[model samples]
Target chain A: MSNFTIPVGPLHVALEEPMYFRIDVHGETVNNVTITAGHVHRGVEYLITKRNVFQNVVLTERICSLCSNSHPQAYSMAIEQIAGIRIPARAEYLRAIADEIKRVASHLFNVGVLAHLVGFESLFMHVMEVRERMQDVKESIFGNRMDIGANTIGGVRYDIDPERIGYLREQLAALVPEVDEIIEIYRTDSSILRRTRGIGVLSYDDAIDCGVVGPVARAAGIEYDVRVKAPYAAYDRLDVPVHVLKDGDVWSRAMIRLMEARTAIDLIHQCLDGLPDGPTVAMDERPAIPPGEAIAKCEAPRGELIYYVRMTDSPKPERVKWRVPSFLNWDALGIMLRQAKVSDIAIIVNSIDPCISCTER
Target chain B: MLDTTTIPLAVLLFPGGLFALAFGLALKGLDRRVAARLQGRVGPPLAQPFFDLVKLARKRTMVPDIAAEPVFLGTPLIGAVSMLLAAALVPIPGVYAPNPLLGDLLVLLYLLAVPAVVLMIAGSASGSPFGAIGFSREMALMLAYEGPLVLVVAAVALRVGSFSLSDIVAYQQTHGAFLFDPVMWPALLAFLAFYPANLGIVPFDIPEAETEVLEGPLLEYSGPALGLFKMMSALKAVVVLGLGVALFLPLAPDGPAGLAVHLAKLVVLMLVGVTLLRVSMGRMRIDQAFAFFLKWPLALSVLSLAIVALA
Candidate 1:
C-alpha cells in the first residue's frame, strides 16, 4: 500500500453539507488532508447587501439552519447598536430564552450525529428522540422547528406566555433525565470511547493555533464562551457555565456539547423565571435608519457568531457580513487528521461540527 | 453409502438452494425488524431485503470504465454460487444429513473462506480507491480471524475425533451438547466473535463501512450484480449459523420437530448475536478489529484446543 489520495465528499454520507477533502494516505493512515469547500456557496454575503436592513434579518437566518436563531439575533443586535435603541428588560430575557432553546437543540443534534458517525445507531436514535422534545418546544413557542423566527430589529419576535412557560418547563424536566442518561452512556460506553478517545487528538497548542471556537475550542481546554466573555441579550444576567475538557479528542468535543446542552436547559429556565413584564418591542413603530456601522457578537450553539452591519441613507444596508464559527474551526482539521486512520476521518470532521453553508456563505 | 440420486434434490430443494435462500432472507428480515424495534423506529417490512433484491435485479449492472469488467462481473457469481454449495454441506441435524460423497468439515472451511476471497478480487478489479482499501482491510481481517476459526474447528474435531459434521452432531447428541461443556466454552466464545466478523456487522464492518468507504467493494456494484452479492450474504447467514448449530448444539427430536428446532435456533442467533450486537456498538478501525481478533479469539481458540485435548 503506497501513498494514494481518496476523496471524502461533496456528497458523502457522513457530512450533512457539501465539502470535499482530497486526502493522501499511506496504507490506511492519512498523511495529509486537502479540503476543497464552496459547494454550498450561495453568495449569501452579496445577497445580504441587496436586502434592506429589516429584510436582511430573514436572509441571515437562512444562512445556516442549526444556528438560524443566532444569525438574526446577532444581526438585529448590531442594527440596534447602530440605531442606539436599548430594548426593554423583558425583550432581553425573551432573546436569551430563544438563544438558549436553539442552543439546546443544536448541541444535541451535533452529539447525536457523533453517535451516528461512531456507528452507535441505538444511541444515535435515542439522542435524536430526546432532542425531539426541544424541537417540539421550538414549534410550540416560535411556530417553527428549525428556523424559529425569534428575533426582530428591536427585540424578539416571539414571546412566551404562562401556558407556554409551563409546557417548556415540563419538557425540560423530562429532557434533563434523558440527557443525563445519554451522557452517562457516552461516558462509559467502551465502543464509543475506543473509537473516539485519543483518536483525533488536537493538542491545546494546536487548538489555539487553529483558533477553533465553540465545543471544538472548549474541548481543547480554551476557557472561552462569548456568552460569558462578552455577554449579550440577558446572558450577562444569567449564570452561564462553560464546560471545558483537556483531551481535545472527538469524544471530548461531543462530551462538551452534551454538557452545554444540559447547561442551556438551565439557562432557559433562568430566563423564564426572570421574565420581566414590559413591551416586547423597543418602539411603537419601525425607527428611522441613520447612516452608521456596528458590530455585534453572540454565543451561537457552535461558538462565537459575529455580525457586521453598515447602513447608508437607503433602507437596504451598505454591507452586511458575518463571521460564522465554522470559518475558524475548519482550519483545525489539518491538525486533527494528521496521522489519523482513514476510519476516523468522518468522526474527526464531524467533531468540528463544520457548517459548510455558514462557512461557504 | 454415497447416494448420487439424492444429491441434486438435497442441494436444490429441501435444505440448500431455495429453502436456504428463503430461510436466510427471512433471518435477514427478522434481524432488521428486531434492530429497528430496538432503535425505537418502525423499520422496513420483513420482506424488504427480498424487495431490494427484486428491485436490484431489475436495475442495470454497471461496469466502471477503469474496472476489469469480466473479473468485476464474475466475482459476485462465484461468491453466490459458493455459498449455495456451502449451504448444502451443513447438516440440519435429525432432519437432513449431507451424503459422505459431497465433502465434509475441511471442505466447508475452505468454502467458508470463498466470499472474502471473492470480495478481495472484486474490490481490486473495480479499480476504485475505496475498493482497494476494502480489499486490504478484508485481507487483514481474514488473516486475523481465520487462524482462530480453524483452531476452533480443530478443537471440536479433536473432542469428537472426527471431521465429519454429522458425527460431531451425533457425538454431541449422546454426550450432551458441547455448548454446555466448560471445556468447549472458550471455543464457543471464539466462534461467537468469529461469526460477527465473518458476517461483516458493526465493530467488525470497517472494510465496507458505508460512512467511511461507501460500502467499499460493493460501492461499484449495482443491479443484478449487486443482487448476487446480497444473495451471497443472505445464503451465508444460513451456512454460518447452520454450521455453528451443527458443531455445538445439534440436540433435537428427529423428524419435523428437529427442523422446527433448528430454524428456531438460527432465528435466535440472528436476532441476538447479529441484530442486537450491530445496533449497540460503533465500528472499530481496521487495525483495532484485527488486533482484537488476534488477541482475544485466537488466544481463546488455542486455550479451548489445549483444554479439549487434555480433558
Candidate 2:
C-alpha cells in the first residue's frame, strides 16, 4: 500500500532498445512517472557543425541509424531553403523515393520489435524476414541497411540506374502481397489483436497536447505530416496522402504503419513510372554558409522529426538543435502507462517506436 | 516381487537419476518441436536441449546487483528438485521407484509447479519494474491455473479411491485403468483443460508475454542461473508429461514382462499427449485461458467426482 519507486530501462528489462522510466507505484497503480533522459547522448549537435555543409550531409545521416535518411533529408531541406536553390524536378522526385523507402523499413523494424515484445515471436520473426527484402533494396541502392545515405545538400547523391530501378520496383511489387499478408496476420489474428487493441489508448487531444507526430499523431487522428501539410522536396510533386486514425492505441499505431508501408510501395511505383530525364543532383553553385536561421520538419519513422539550424555564415553552424521524435514521443509514455497494468508498458513504449540512441543524440 | 528388499544397482543407474534427467530433456525438446511444427516451422534439433544445458552449465553466473541472494540460487534448486522428485514417482510403466511416496500425485503437482513459482519470485527480487511486472503476470497466471489443476487431479484421486499415487495406479490396473472407467470422459476433459495451464501455452502464457512483459520471470534470469532455469524448464516439461502418464494413464507395470510393458505404455501416453497438443490448439488469451481451465475443468472434475461417488 505504500508508495514505492520502480525504475524501468537503462539496464533493466525491455522488449526493445533501452530507455529509462522511474515510476512511482502505489500497489498496482502508477501514481506518477518521472522520466530521466540523456542516457544515449552522443553530443551529435556539437559534432555536426564541426564540418562544412558538404561533409555535414553524411554527418547528419549519422544522427540515427534507423532515422538515418530523415536526418540528411531534413538537413539538406534546410540547406536547400537557405541556398535559394530550386532542386531539379527529378531531384525532388528522387528525394521522395529515398524518404518513402526509409519510412517503410523503419516502420517494419518498429512493428517487428512490437511483435517481439508481445511474445508473438513467430510474427516478430516473420515481419523481420519481410523487412529483409526492404533491406536488400536499401543495400542495393545505398550500401547500408540501417543508414541509407541518399540525401545531399541540393538534391540526392545517389542515382538509380535503369537496372537498379527495375530491381527496386520488382522488390516493392513483390513486397505488396506480403505486406497485405502481414496486415491480415496482424489484424485477423486474435492473440495479437487482444494484446495490442485498447492496450495503450492515446486520445486525439492528448496527442496534440503531447506534440506527438507522424504515425503516433496519425493514430490519434492528426493530419499533420510534414510531407503532406508543408510539402518539401519531392513530396510536393507526389500526391501523398497522410494516413490518420481516430483511436490512437497500439493497434492503430501498427495499422498506420501497415497502411503507410502500402503507400510507400504505391509511391515507389509512381516514382518509377515518372522517372525524370534530368540529373539527380543540381549543377548550380550551392549557397555559401548563409548567416541565417533555417528550420525544417520531416516525417521520421517514429514521428515528425524537426531540425533547427542557426548559422552565422561560418563554415560550421553557430547552433544546431533538433526535436528528436523519440524525445517528444517519450513524453507520452507517462500518460499512456498511468492506468494500464505493468505488463503493457513495454508494448505501449514499443508502439511509439522509442529510439533511445536517436533521441538521446 | 523380485526380492522386495535390496534394489538392483542396474535399476538405480538405468532408471533413477540419469533416466529422469534424460526424460526431462527429451520432453523439453519434444515440446519445442511440437510448438514449432504447429506454427509452420522447423524448430531446434532434438539435441538442442542437451546443447543448451551444457551451455548454461558453462555460463558464468552473475547475480544482479539489486537481487536478493538466495532467491536467485535457491529457486532453480527447488525447481530442479521438484522436477527430479516428480520424475521419481511417474511410474515409468515397469520401473520401480526407490521411493514411490514422492509421487503422492498432489506432491508431484506442487513440486512441478515450484519452478514457475520460484521463477516469479526470482524475477521480482531483481528490483526492476519490467521484471516486477513480468513476475506479477506470472503470479496471476499461477493463481488462475493452480486451483483448477488441483481440482482436476483431486477428482482423479477420488475416482481411484485414494490420494496415494501408487495406490491409484494399483487400483486402475486391477479395475480397468481409471481412464477406461465410466468416469473416463469427464476425467479426459479435465485433463485436456489442465494441459494448457500446465504448459503455460497460448493465452495462459501471460507471464512471459515477451512483447509486453518482456520475458516476465525470465527478465532477470541471465547467465548460469538462467541456464539452470532453462534446464529446469525442460525438466519441468518432462515432469508434466510424467504426471500426465501417472495421473491420467495410470499404467500398471506388473507381471513377468511388466517392467518393459509399463515403461513402453508410459512413453506412448506422453507421445500421444504431445501429438494432441500439436494438432488441437494454439495459445489462448490470459483471461480466456483462465475461464476455460477453471469453468470447464471444474465442471468436468465435479462430474468425474460425482460418477465415482455414485459408482
lDDT by residue (B113-205, candidate 2, tens digit) is: 787788778777776565676566666667766766677677777777777766666676667665666666786777765665666654456
True contacts kept of 2: 0.27
The lDDT values for all models are 0.92, 0.73
TM-score of candidate 1 relative to the true fold: 0.99
Which digits, one per residue and each the tens of the lDDT, describe model 2 over residues A193-298? 8778887888998988998877888999988887787887767667787888899999999999988988988988888788787987776666576677889888
TM per candidate? 0.99, 0.87
Candidate 1 CAPRI classification by DockQ:
high
> How much is the TM-score of the A chain of model 2?
0.95
The prediction achieving the highest lDDT against the true structure is 1
The candidate scoring highest on TM-score is 1
Candidate 1 TM-score on chain B: 0.98
Off by over 4 Å in 1: B1-5
